[model samples]
Target chain A: DTAVSQTPKYLVTQMGNDKSIKCEQNLGHDTMYWYKQDSKKFLKIMFSYNNKELIINETVPNRFSPKSPDKAHLNLHINSLELGDSAVYFCASSQGSGRVYEQFFGPGTRLTVL
Target chain B: QQQVKQSPQSLIVQKGGISIINCAYENTAFDYFPWYQQFPGKGPALLIAIRPDVSEKKEGRFTISFNKSAKQFSLHIMDSQPGDSATYFCAASYLEDDYKLSFGAGTTVTVRA
Candidate 1:
C-alpha cells in the first residue's frame, strides 16, 4: 500500500500556464508539507498544513498556493509558471510536528516549465 | 537560501566498505538533524536522525555523528552495499518550526559491487 501519493507524476507545460498537483496520504498523518527540489538537488520547504489548517509558509512566491481539503490531502496550485519553476515537487506527511515524528515522502511530481 | 551545507557532492565506494557523507550548518538553532536517502524517480526516505544533545546515534548499519560544538554532523553507512547507491540529503529542523525541514544539497552515493 502507498503511504503517501502525488498525482501528475510528470508535468510539462509552457510558461504563463496554470497547473495543480494533488497529494494524499493513507498513513493517517496530521501534518502535510510541500517541498521543492531544485536542479542542484536542494530541497526546501514551501508550505505546511496541519489538520486542514495552514501552518508553515516559507518565503515561497505568492503564485504558489497550497490547499488541504482534509487531513488526508494537500494540493498545490501554481499560477503563471516560469522557467525557474521547473523542478520536482514533493509531498510529505508526518504524524505530527516534533523530534519524535518521522516524515514520510511521496513519489514526487516532476514539473517542467518550458 | 539554503541553511545546511553538504560536502562531497558525490562519492563512489566499494561493497563492504563504509560510505561517509558530511554536512555543516551555520544556524545553531537547528536542534534536530536527520538524514534521508532518495533513489532516482522516488521520494526521499528517512534513514536516521539525531539531536544535538547527543554525539552519535546508530541504527542498523547507519550511524549519525553529531558535533554540536563544531556545528557539523555526518552520516556513516557501514557495510555499504550496491543497493545503497542513491542520493543522500541531510536536513535540519528547529523546535519552533519543527515541521519545516531545511535540507542541504544532496550528495550522490554510488556503491560498487
Candidate 2:
C-alpha cells in the first residue's frame, strides 16, 4: 500500500488559470505539509498543518493556499497562477510537528504553467 | 538559524566504490539527523539516521558518521552499485517540536557500472 499519494501527477495550464492538487496519506499521521520543488530541485516548505490546524506558513505568496479537511488529507490550491508557478508540488505527512519531524513524502505533482 | 547545509551538489562514483555526502547544521537544538534517498520520479525514502549522542551508526552498507561538537554529519555508502544512484538529502530536527525536520539541498549521486 502506498503510504502517501498525490493526485493530478501531471498538470499543464496557462497563466491566470487556477488549479488544485489533492493529497492523502494512510500512515496514520497527524501532521501534513505542502512543499514546492523548483526546477533546480530545491525543495521549500510552503505550509504545514497539524490536526487540521495551520501551523507553519513560510514566505510563500498568498496565491497559494493549503487546506486540510482532516488529519489524513491536505490539498493545495493556486489562484491566478503565473509562469513562475511551474514546478513539482509535493505532499508530506508526519506524526507530529516541530521536533518530532520525520516526514513521509508523496510522489509529487508536476505543474507546468505556460 | 535552523538551516541545514549540504555539500557536493552532485557526485559520480564507480560501482563497488564508496559514496559520501556531507552536511552541516547551525542549530544546536537539533538532536536527530536522518538521510533520505530519492530515485527518479519517486519521493524520498528514509535511508539512515543518527543522533548527536552517537558518533557513528551503521546499517547494512549505509553508515552515518556524526560529530556532535562540530555539528557535522555524513552519509557513507559502501560497495555502492548503480542501483544505489539517487538524490540524497540530509535533514536535522529537534525533539522538542513534533519533529519538524529541516532539509538541505539534495546531493545527486551517480554510480556508474
Candidate 3:
C-alpha cells in the first residue's frame, strides 16, 4: 500500500485560473506538509499541519491556502495562479513534530501555469 | 534567505567511483541534518541523516559527515553505480521548530557505468 498519495499527478492551467491539489497519507502520521520545488530544484516548505492545527506558515502569498480536513489529509488551493507558480508540489507526513522522525513524501504533482 | 547552502550543483562520476555532495547551514539551532535522494517525477526520499552529537554516520554505501562547529554536513556515496544517479538534497531542522525543514538547492549526480 502506498503510504502517501497525491491526486492529479500533473496539472496544467492557464494564468488567473484557480486549482487545488489533494494529498492523503495512510501512515497514521500526526503532521502533514506542503512543499514547493522550483525549477532550480530548491525545495521550500509552504505549510505544515500538526493534528489538523496550523503549525508552520511560510512567507507564501495569500493566493495559496492549505486546508487540513483531518490528520490524514492536507489539500493545497492556489488562487489566480501565475506563471511563476509552475513547479512541483510535494506532500509529506511525519509521525509527529519531532526532529527524530523522518518525513515520508508522496509522488510530486507537477503544476504548470501557462 | 536561504538557511542552507549546497555546492557543485551537478556532478558526474564513473561506476565504482565515489560521489560527494557538500552542504552548509547558518543556523546553529538546527539539530537534525538529513540527506534526501530524488529521482525524476518522484518526491525526495530520506537517504541518510545525522545529528550534531555524532560526527559521522554510515548506512550501506551512503555516509553522512557532520561538523558541529562549522555547521556543515556532507554526503558521500561509495562504489557509486549507475542506479545511484539522482538529485540529492541536504536539509536541516530544529527540534524546537516542530520539525519544519529548510532544504538546500539539490545536487544532481550522474554515475556513468
Candidate 4:
C-alpha cells in the first residue's frame, strides 16, 4: 500500500484563482508537514501539524493556508494565487513529533499559476 | 537566513566515479542530519542520515562523513551510476523539535555513463 499520497499531481491555473491540494498518509503517523519547492529547487518548510494541532508555520503569505481535518489528512488551500505561487508542494509524515525525524513523503503536487 | 548551506548546486560525474556533496549548518543545536534524494516529478526520499556522535557512517555505496567541530557534513556516493543521478538535499533538525526541518538549497547530480 502507498504510505503517503496527494491528489491533483498537476494543476495549472491563472492568477486570482483558488485551489486546494489534498494529502493523506496511511503510515499511522502522528505528525504531518507541508513543504514547498520553488523553481530554483530550494525546498522549504511551509507548515506542520501534529495530532491535529498546528505546530510550525513558516514565513508564508496569508494567501496560503493549511487545514488538517485529522491526524491522517492535511490539505492546502490557496486563495487569490499569484504568479509567484507556481511551485511544487510536498506532503510528509513521521511516526512521532519528537525524535523520529525520518519522514515519508508523497508524490508532490505541481501547481502553476500563470 | 538559510541555516544550512550546500555546495556545488550541480554536479556531473562519470559512471563508476565517486560523487561528493557537502553541507554546513550554523546551528549547534542540530543533532540529526539527513540526506534526501529526489527525482523529477517526485518527492524526496530519505537516502541516509547521521548524528553528531558519529564521524562516519557507511551503508552500501553511500557514506556520510560528519565533522561536528566544523559543523559540516558530506555525502559520498561510491561507484556512482547513471541511475543514481538525482537531486540531493541535506537537512538538519534540533533535538527538541520535530515540527521543522532546515534544508539546504539542494544539489543536482548527473552521473554520465
Candidate 5:
C-alpha cells in the first residue's frame, strides 16, 4: 500500500503557464508539507500545514501556493511559472507537527518549465 | 544559507566495508537530527534519527554518533552492500520550528561489490 502518493509524476510546461500538483496520504497524518529540491539536490521546505492551518511559509515567492483540504490531502499550485521553477517538488506528511515525529515522503514530481 | 552542512559530496565503499557520512549545524536550538536515504527516481526514506541528549545511537548495522559540543554528527553504515548505494541526506529541526527540517546537501554513496 502506498503511504503517500502524488499525482503527475512528470510535468513539462511552457514558461508563464500555471500548474498544480496534488498529494494524498493514507497514513492518517495531520501535518503535511511541500518541499522543493533543486538540481543540486538541495531540499528546502516551501510550506507546512497542520490541521488545515498554515504554520510555516518560508521565503518562497507568492507564485507558489499550498492548500490543504483535509488532514489527508495537500496540494500545491504555481502561477506564472518561470524557468527557475524547474525542479522536483515533494510532498510529505507526519503524524504530528513535532520534532519527534518522522515525516514520510512521497515520490517527487519533476517539473520542467520550458 | 543552508543550516546544515555536509561533507564529501560523494563516496565509494567496497562491499563489506564501512561508509561514513558527516554533518554539522550552527544552530544550537536544533534538537532533532535524522538521516534519510534516497535512490534514483525515489523519495527519501528515513534510515535513522538521533536526539541531542544522546551521544550515540546504534540500530543493527546503522549508527549515529553525535557531538553536541562540536555541533556535528556522523552516520556509519557497517558491512555496506551494493544495495546501500544511494544519496544520503542529513537534517535538523527544533520543536518550536513546527518540525521544519533544514536539510544538508546530499551525499551520494556508491557501494562497489
Candidate 6:
C-alpha cells in the first residue's frame, strides 16, 4: 500500500497563476507537514499541522497556505505564484509530533512557475 | 541558518568499498538524528537513526557513529553496491516541538560496480 501519496506529480503554470497540490497518507498519522525543496536541494519546512490543527508556520510568504481537512489529508495552495516558486514540494506525515517517531514522505510535486 | 551541516555534497565509490557521509549539528537541544535515502523521482525513505545517548548503532551493512560531545554523526555503508547509489540526507530534531526536522542539503552517492 502507498503509505503517503501526492497528487499532480508535476505542475507547470504561468506567473501570477494559482495552483494547489493535494496530499494523502494512509499511515494513520496525526501530524502532517509540507516542505519545500529548492534547486540547490535544500529542504525546508514550511508548515506543519497536528490533527488538523496548525502547529508550525515557518517564515514562509502568505501566498502559500496549507489546509488539513482531516488527519489523513493535507493540501497546499499557492496564490500569485512567482518564478521563485519553481521547486519540489513534499508532503510528509508522522504517527505523533514527538521526535522519536519516524516520518513517511510522499512523492514530491514538482512545481514550475514560468 | 542551516542547523544540520553535511559534508561531501557528492561521493563516488566502487563496489565493495566503504562509503562515509558526515554531518554536524549546532543545536545542542537536538537529540534525535536520522539519515534518509532518496532515489530519483521518489521521496526520501528513512534508513537509520540514532539518539544522543547511543554512541553507535549498526544494522546490516549500514552503521551510524555518533559523537555527542562533538555534536557530530556519520553514516557508513559497508560493501557499497551499485544499488546503493542515491541521495542521502541528514536531519536533526528536538523533542520540544512537534518533531520538526532540520535537514542538511544532501549527499549524492554513486556506487559503481
Which DockQ values do the candidates obtain, in the order shown? 0.77, 0.60, 0.85, 0.77, 0.85, 0.85
TM-score of chain A of 4: 0.97
Which tens-of-lDDT digit does each residue in A34-91 have in candidate 1? 9999988888889989889988898899999999999999999999999999999999
Please list the C-alpha lDDT of all candidates, in the order they appear.
0.93, 0.89, 0.94, 0.93, 0.95, 0.93
Q: Model 4: per-residue lDDT, tens digit, B36-108?
A: 9999888999999998999999999999999999999999999999999999999999857662688899999
Off by over 4 Å in 6: none
Q: How big an interface RMSD has model 6?
A: 1.1
Chain B TM-score against the true chain B, each candidate? 0.97, 0.96, 0.98, 0.97, 0.98, 0.98
Q: List the residue pairs that clash in candidate 3.
A: none
Better of 4 and 6 by TM-score: 6
**Which digits, one per residue and each the tens of the lDDT, describe model 2 over residues B24-52?**
98889888899989898987788888888
Task: Assess the local accuracy of residue B78 in candidate 6 as a C-alpha lDDT between 0 and 100.
Answer: 99
- Clashing residue pairs in candidate 6 are none
**What TM value does chain B of candidate 6 have?**
0.98
iRMS (Å) per candidate: 1.5, 2.1, 1.1, 1.4, 1.1, 1.1
What value does DockQ give for candidate 3?
A: 0.85
Top candidate when judged by lDDT against the true structure: 5
- Fnat of all models, as shown: 0.88, 0.60, 0.93, 0.81, 0.91, 0.95
Model 5 lDDT, residue B69, Cα:
100
Q: Is candidate 1 or candidate 3 better by TM-score?
A: 3
lDDT of 5 by residue, B1-113 (tens): 99999987999999999999999999999999999999999889999999999999999999999999999999999999999999999999998787689999999999999
